[model samples]
Target: MTGSLISPRVDYASDPARSRGRFQIEPESRTRTPFQRDRDRIIHASAFRRLKMKTQVFVAHEGDHFRTRLTHSLEVAQIARSVARTLGLDEDLAEALALAHDLGHPPFGHAGEDQLDECMEAFGGFDHNAQTLRVVTRLEQRYPTFDGLNLTFETLEGLIKHNGPVLKNGKRMQDLPQAFLDFEHLEQLDLDTYAGPEAQVAALSDDIAYNNHDIDDGLSAGLFTIEDIKDVPLVGRIFHQVQKDYPLLDRQRVISEAVRRLIGVWIEDLTAETSRRAKRLNPKSVEDVRNLNEPLVAFSEKLDAEQKELRRFLMERMYRHYKVNRKRSQAKRILKELFGLFLSEPDTLPPPWNETAQQMTKDARARVVCDYIAGMTDNYAIDEHRRLFNLDAMI
Candidate 1:
């Protein structure tokens, strides 16, 4: 490949030089490809920095050892770059997508997202993917000419469509998120087809990273024991093997070894399956990869089934554990109260946001409030809730 450190670039890999270009044209970087520049921009974004304070399955205040969105994104980027390089795809684009994927996530993880969606339901429900697009295309305001980061079309397309085609058949299954609809007028993304191979790699990398980390977090939180997960599919087998090989190892070391081995197995399966798919499909270019009926990157069927079982275990023992649910409930309340307050009393918002909300319609005002709440870090949200709700607290 053109930028590959190990292997030659595949014919179907996305080429930064052939990128569709940014919405706002600018001088190209002399030191980096367009995709590399995109990665740099994402790394420098304010939203990306806030990810450090955004928790995944656990609240940030709960424990320092738990995985935050920032760590998760970094882990995903590492896995993505590894997969992209192994498959002769553009590692920079995969890394960029992985880094930017969670930039739109609100404080408190899924609980906050769910509350925000309910708060914004009448004004066009919130979708994290759409919120992510908005963050890059219109929310960030560091640039002199544009409000958001002027990312490449390839990065934007992957951000919007990484999970799959946005459209079902020839039409949207439902209305596009308002943010997505707003951006579509500026540039038409081919939403009916799959994203290019780098994006596909980044998407799967996210799955691999989160699954393994959640197991680690769940165990650390004491929501479940090693014995509890000893019967799960792929994960259980790995844990058993680790125990057999090092019978006297400590619990933490066993967990760490098992997670490490599981991640390696997932990466191997994904790369091999993707290579097999590419050989059978014989795509000539990135466009050919996108136009195919299915994704070019995937785990094997056996692995996929096993992965689902692992997810089910996490869902029951970890995600739905009483401790996690307690934090989630508190998170939802904070977001809900904040949204209600901001929407009803726009003048209470900070200076610029207050000024902006004054001129918008009610629906528009709701969106503005949504944007404000969505940008808060977990600790900030909690502190803001206390400041606003407790009369005894200093303003």
Candidate 2:
């Protein structure tokens, strides 16, 4: 794969020069394409900066070596760029989607998200994907001219619909998040269709990165041993090959080598599979890719089955392990306490948040509080809970 040359640019690859333009028009950059500017803006946003301390799988304070949201985003960008480059897609757009993917993930990984969803049930449910749309469209608050990063239509479309169209079978989505509804009122994302091919590549790149990295984290945390995972499908085969090739290799090296190979194999398979699909679909333009019913980017059936098996292994062995469950329980408590306190006693919230909460209606007030908590880092959430609830710590 390293020696393979980039294919000639395809008509279906997103063209930055021909971008649909930002919501708020400005002078074109002398040095950057529209997508490049979008990527740069996201990299500099406060939400992007906060991802450094946000939990990926393990809480940030759990260990120095664990993958935080920031590191995970970077890894996803690398994989996305490689896939984009190999397929003659726009590398910058793929990288942008990869980097911006998790900007809306709350403090303690899925645990925080789950708690937030329950707390907001009265107002509107919370979803990280919808929150990501909110972050870019309205939450970032950097520019004097715009409330959020005024990105191109392509970027916005990709970010919101990266998981395919929001609608199911030509019906309007039931219970769409308030943020998504708000954005659609402003500028419709055509949520009935799949995102362009670049977005599809970025989404698959996320799956590739998380699956492999979670294994590394789980092993390091002693949740499961390397030997315990040797019976899993695709991963198990990679491990066996690595061990047989390097009989005396240390455990750490064995895991690393096997994971590296696993990522490579997946990338190779994805590139081949996507190309095959493109040939059959004969998409005339980027729009044609979106209009198609099937996803342009996908894994082969065999690999997809194997990947599902790996997910099951991780779910039972790592996600449901007692240690992780305990952490998740504590995380839920902190978020619930914070949400309840902030809503009941809006004055307790800090200066601007207090003022902001005071000015909103009930549902809006809850949404504001939700945003504040969702933006917190794992340690910040713990510290904030301590400040609010622990007398000794407050003292």
Candidate 3:
């Protein structure tokens, strides 16, 4: 079976021009590919800069190391790069996709998202994943003639793969590609199928990163306890899974240490399983291809199921806690006041806003209203609320 299962190495999509650039930092006496260029471009974009102003689970200013979207993206990039390298896949593509994945998230974290969706319900409810793709491809206008980033097909496909790929013309990344809807296009299947190992690794790595960090953030917010987490049936299963495998179940360091061990366990299982299959079939020839012997990416299904249950636990016990509800209610009142006062009495709005609002179309005004409210940081939101309502004096 050495060569029997192998197909010829045919890349219909890896062309340099496919990524829309002629090399901004041309080879320092070398050649850089388009995907590599894409990665670098993202490393410097302003939208990426705004990530510092955005929230992950907690407010961005809470602590230096507490995760921001920027921090989360960096972590995801590191994890994705590690997995992609180990799997013999293109690391640049994985890195670029991971870095750009959350670029569309609005301010004030997901609360801002909930508000945006509620406000835009008539405009086809908001989805961060789709919005992410839009940011790089269209909405993120960094320059004239640059309403979109015009990223490579691979990067775009991965961004939209959160739910599934869209198709247009005959390509997976074309504007809602028609080929994607045909169901016969194997390569166009939603990420659940046919994604190369990098794509799969990137997906699971995101889950791993967010799950662990959300728990960390929840604790920081004084929202949950190790004891509380340990009591859940599924959470208990995870804790036990870690203790049975890891030697240093140090009580003071348990959760963070456990997260690392769990990551290693999944990586080991995935690597061993794929390597066994490759050797069993004597896949020498295919393994010679750039990324062939690289293990197919996967997480333990058991672990993934455990994570889902754990997240539900957080949602019920921490995220929906009354204190959190109070904060969100305060947030809503602030947003509603800002929206109503700014729009209803544009005369009283900040100077630039009045002009901006006057020029905004009805749909555009609604979107601007969402953006205006979403852009307010926690303290800014509160202060603006007081100032607008005359509950407090302005600066």
lDDT over C-alpha atoms for residue 219 of model 2 = 95
Ranking by TM-score: 2, 1, 3
lDDT of 2 by residue, 207-280 (tens): 99999999999999999998999899989989999999999999999989989999999999999999999999
Whole-model lDDT values for every prediction: 0.92, 0.91, 0.60
Can you tell me which runs of candidate 2 are displaced by over 4 Å? 1-4, 170-174, 184-187
Badly placed stretches (over 4 Å) of model 1 are 1-5, 169-174
lDDT tens digits by residue: candidate 3, 101-182: 8877776677767766776675445657666765665545665554556566566666766433233235434334221222
List pairs with backbone clashes in candidate 2: none
- Taking all chains together, each candidate's TM-score versus the true structure is 0.97, 0.98, 0.72
Instruction: For each candidate in turn, give its C-alpha RMSD to the true structure in angstroms.
Output: 2.3, 1.4, 7.5
> Number of clashing pairs, model 3?
5
For residues 1-395, write the lDDT of model 1, one tens digit per residue.
46634668999999998998988889999999999999999999999999999998888988899999999999999999999999999999999999999998999999999999999889999988999999998899998887889999899999999688898666664567776887853337888889999999999999999999999989988999999998999888899999999999999999999999999999999999999999999999999999999998999999999999999999999889998899999999999999999998999889899999988899999999999999999999999999999998748
Mark the 10 consecutive residues where model 2 has the least summed lDDT: 181-190
